[model samples]
Target: MDILDWIQNWFKSNCDGDWEHGDGIQITTLDNPGWDVEIDISKTSIASMNLDWILNENSKQDWYGVKIENQKFNAAGDSGKLIFLLGLFKEMIEKIENNTIG
Candidate 1:
């Protein structure tokens, strides 16, 4: 399957609480307040630079924000809902970047 399909499957049957899937993307609202997870996939090379998202100071080190194979690691924050989501997204992105999309 492609990245979007993989992401859809990932969240389709897995979530802490209520969730939503539409427009070819998956989203899970955190059980806690002020947090949420939005995941999507692209069918083009990561180098294409058309994902249409940005990473600011608060999101620079985010899972989907950071670029794969970048050696410069920056300390962002602690473990929690955001970090958990980050781990998931980062892993998925890495898979595609490394030509191991499955």
Candidate 2:
């Protein structure tokens, strides 16, 4: 699977509708070639978390982040979601670097 395909699978696996529908995360492709990824997540209190990644050409990887809204729960709520996002992104990057996809 390529990076994009990997990402799609990762997100599909983690999708959960039971959680408090805070806000659906919106992912956008940056103007740059297909490497840049932008994430806009809605948090509580009408606030939002925005992140951008500039994937390295060599590693086929990048860094991204998000701030948990409300943050009533610990990482379980916020961290878990953020970590899942990062993990999926990392997994996708690795798949691309290794050229491993089904």
Candidate 3:
């Protein structure tokens, strides 16, 4: 499935009429010509999952970083790394769902 579609489904699945009120996903552009992504996971199935920060700095225009902090999934990357950033989140969720991680 498209990453956007999968992410949308994930967000929808977490909406319990209240979780969506004060907490949700946020995707914005950074001044450094990159993408910023934040998804609140405080009340979800994977809220307690532990994932250390993952970062890759291949070049000035090819870099990304992701981490779960303060009950939220956060990520940022160069202009071309948006998909990769989201892919990281997707992979993490899949791993947890498949019982491959805690």
Best by TM-score: 3
Per-residue CA lDDT of candidate 2, range 1-102, in tens? Answer: 555566566456545763225423344343322222223222222233222333222322333333333422111112114445545545544564576843
Q: Which runs of model 2 end up more than 4 angstroms from their true locations?
A: 29-88, 91-102
- Candidate 3 per-residue C-alpha lDDT over 8-102 given as tens digits, one digit per residue, 9 for 90 to 100: 89988988999899759889999989999998879866887656788889988888988887889999999988888889889888987798974
After superposition on all C-alphas, the RMSD of every candidate to the true structure, in Å, is 12.6, 12.4, 1.4
Q: Considering lDDT, which of the candidate structures 2 and 3 is the better prediction for this target?
A: 3
Pairs that clash in candidate 1: none
lDDT of 3: 0.87
Using alpha carbons, what is the TM-score of model 2?
0.29
Relative to the true structure, candidate 3 reaches a TM of 0.90
TM-score of each: 0.30, 0.29, 0.90
